[model samples]
Target: MLPQPSGPLRLAVGGLTSITDDFAFFTYNLCDYRRTGRSDEARYARVEEVIRELVRPGTPTVGAVQELPGDDWTSAAHGLGHLASATGLHCQAFTDGTRSAAAVPGGHDCLGLGLLWSAEVDPIADTLRYISGGPLWHALVMVDLNVGGHRISAASYHAPPKAGRDRRTAEAGLVATTLRSHAGDGGEIWLGADWNSPSSRTTDGLYYDPDPTEMVTSADRQRWGDDLPEIGYRTDRTPDMIMADAGFRDAAVEYGAPWAPTTGHGPNDRNGPRRIDRILYRPAAAAPGGVA
Candidate 1:
């Protein structure tokens, strides 16, 4: 079971997982060392140069070139080291951005939850190697910390608008499968992504309605019902359905944070189109007084 984000217990945060999607905005920390990690003019710049040389365009591949899994693991480990070296954050890159590299370069975007205290990241190889089916580099990084703890997992995915019910269901299954691998007895697990799922359902299996006490504003509630009901590819299907099936509850639903939405379409469009990009955890038992 995953922990709930409440009472100063196990805290987890997440962001849209689509590393390269413009909609999934976040500075690419992997390549953009200066922007990604802490400050150190000389060190950060040098690390950035090394990454560019390793994966440079139209130049001799100076470093080792391996399969997607190998490359991803290597990159994440390296990135984590860089973060630690710069700011002592000890941040680790979980999902493999290589999935979007071919189509979307500079992909290492993470959910802007907060600094993840800890997590367990998993990677997909076969699917990631393919180009047609979106990136397979998804993960369930277990996080710990409080409000200041910027922690989150990534489920970066973008499918054709036509992929309605079936696709959303399949995507849900994938998230469930991933959670099953890392879930604990009482910790919370977060699945962050540009699920493309309209906020029709909550991660805990409840439908979003116009109850200000239970949900966001009437306009936000209407967005779930009318606009684009079918999230992902299938009709009446969405990413929430996936998390709900996995035994996880919605943080925004169970906890009251409707005012804080995750997926904003554009810069100016602060209150832009919405998606349940950040999925929270529902522990079987609530920590007494919120103590882990």
Candidate 2:
């Protein structure tokens, strides 16, 4: 059994892309949205220190992390080690690419696996079906670290809007399928992502909707066709709605507001702000973190 800590365990899901030396990209707690990718170690270290000092202690956070190696997989592992060591935060990073660590990563408490699928039409449908239709979507072989008596299995992904509406809908369907597969479950599950759904909150002056009807530009229509079914078409619309249908509760909804703002990556879109990146929890046998 894992050592059950007395403090709260907080899980954070966000985007981290290392672009160049000293220039990096971050969303959520990390500042500058963009930074010198070369100094990711320094940048992330500072961020971790701030989080540790400002936020509650013993909060295990996992974000969508990217590592590009100038050499081989070994170099990648070394890079990851540097990040964890620098921050004094033990972490496990999972990436399908050779740039990931030597050890496998998965689940809530431990390093977790990351899955990526392309939008090529021929294999897209098959890939979606396989991941969601079985235990693969909720696979949590390594997340058993928390002593909370409840396990948290999480999956993070980005939907392909440029792939067209039909393709996007199919992907959303796969998300729905995964939710169904995990329904009536005892463990906790969270799916996080920058899903460019039609009902995304509007902000600033950039009126954007993932809706095909509103996207009448010839180029956009061709890319996002009219035939595809947008699971929901209003501001309240989202893939979470599908999860709700399958018995999951919106974690943000529990607070009557979202945790962050729209476009976790792009410029802050709204004057009022909105949260597109979501955290959904499956009904659990017992509360994991203890009453939010």
Which candidate number would show the highest lDDT if scored against the true structure? Answer: 2
* Candidate 1 runs further than 4 Å off: 1-71, 83-87, 92-115, 118-166, 184-188, 202-236, 265-271, 284-292
lDDT (Cα, 0-100) at 189 in candidate 2: 50
What is the C-alpha RMSD, rounded to one decimal, of candidate 2?
A: 12.6
Residues 1-292 of candidate 1 have per-residue lDDT tens digits of 2223342111112122211111111212122333333455774555434333222232111111111121243443444444434432223323344322211212223211112221222222222211123432223222332211222232223322322434556656665665445434444434433444454454445544222212333422323333354421122445566566667655456554543444342344323444435443444335422312
- Candidate 1, lDDT over the whole model: 0.34
- Name the weakest run of 10 consecutive residues (lDDT summed) in model 2: 117-126
Report, for every candidate in turn, its global Cα lDDT versus the true structure. Answer: 0.34, 0.35
Distance (Å) between predicted and true CA of 130, model 1? Answer: 17
| Candidate 2 residue spans exceeding 4 A from truth | 1-55, 59-83, 93-147, 161-165, 179-184, 198-238, 258-260, 264-274, 286-292
